[model samples]
Target: MPQHLTIVTHPLVSHKLTIMRKKETSTAGFRKLLREISLLLAYEVTRELPLTTETIETPIETMEAPVIEGRKLALVSILRAGNGLLDGILELIPAARVGFIGLYRDPETLQPVEYYKKLPEHMEDRYTIVVDPMLATGNSSVAAIDMLKAAGAKNIRFLCLLASPEGVARMKAAHPDVPVVTAALDRGLDDHGYIVPGLGDAGDRMFGTR
Candidate 1:
């Protein structure tokens, strides 16, 4: 079993994913569906967030209400494609601290190459959620986690819209502790490293770029 993986099979998630998978889906439609699906995914990913009671006065009486505990959360988007997932998550967590990591695959070698990264200070003190729309080969995901740990982020979660079996296995082997929350786990990756039935380059679909 993939202990750390959580495939969000919620009806809404699956429904939107189906539309996204259709090759005829327009860029506008794809982007909108992604934004909606990501919000649902965010809910699943953060379902285990710790809560604390706070004293508050209601219209009727003073009471203790539950609120998230400790420092604010840190949301790390794994670059351009991650931004699609990040935008929707921000709608749900407007106050979360934001960070970005940019990585591009070397065309010939098919290896991830980091080009940019910026994270919030005191990362160890916050719960970090890394967002990306697709986890295909897992090279970028693993490398991103490596960077987070090196920067003192201990508690971390990986959130994505889609994953391949190969990607999930690779992530578990590399970072067994970090939970993986995705909308679907496809059959596997193709020879060229793309998820076999994935929606295709999420960044391109979302931004209308190749």
Candidate 2:
């Protein structure tokens, strides 16, 4: 099992993230970079997945090959920004079972409120990975994982493009059993609960909305 938090330090991921943080980057460019970066982050998050060997016949001979051991993974997106990350990961693992959990932060309280949820069945049997673009306050991510556990998801992981120290700590305190994989951990959140020196509202940037 990976640690409570794993920051992906891959050079490609870092370079792309730098471009994403720029204020002048267009919506189209930001969306494109997010999809590309998610692919790299996906590679890191699934690194510790269990593996088993299986016999296979090659063109010339028969041999044993390593294969992922378990049910088709469940990828849950914490909408609506999570869709950006989910799209790229789905490209890499096309057969993965997909689901969605809709949660919006209450601006006044800075808390999460669930509006919708649709998860794959037999979550307990699957290696579930929850995708969200930012772990700014960690309120929504924690709430999402709480719902997943209630749905019987035991082997769960959280994947995000960026995180703040406060958010990471909050997640650690609330859900220590779930590991977190992120491209970068930026400075703490600002007064408005947004990460400082971080990419702006991910959903807005990705969808060309205010």
lDDT of 2 at 127: 93
Worst 10 residues of 2 by lDDT: 1-10
For model 2, the stretches where C-alpha displacement exceeds 4 angstroms are none
What C-alpha RMSD separates each model from the true structure? 1.5, 0.7
With candidate 2 superimposed using the best TM-score fit, by how many Å does residue 139's alpha carbon deviate from the native? 0.5
lDDT of 1 by residue, 105-181 (tens): 87777778999999999999989999999999999999999999999998899999999999999999999999999
Q: Lowest-lDDT window of 10 residues in candidate 1?
A: 1-10
Q: Candidate 2 on 1-210: residue-level lDDT in tens?
A: 579999999999999999999989999999999999999999988998889999999999999999999899999999999999999999999999999999999999999999999999999999999999999999999999999999999999999999999999999999999999999999889999999889999999999999
Sequence-dependent TM-score of model 1: 0.97
TM-score of each: 0.97, 0.98
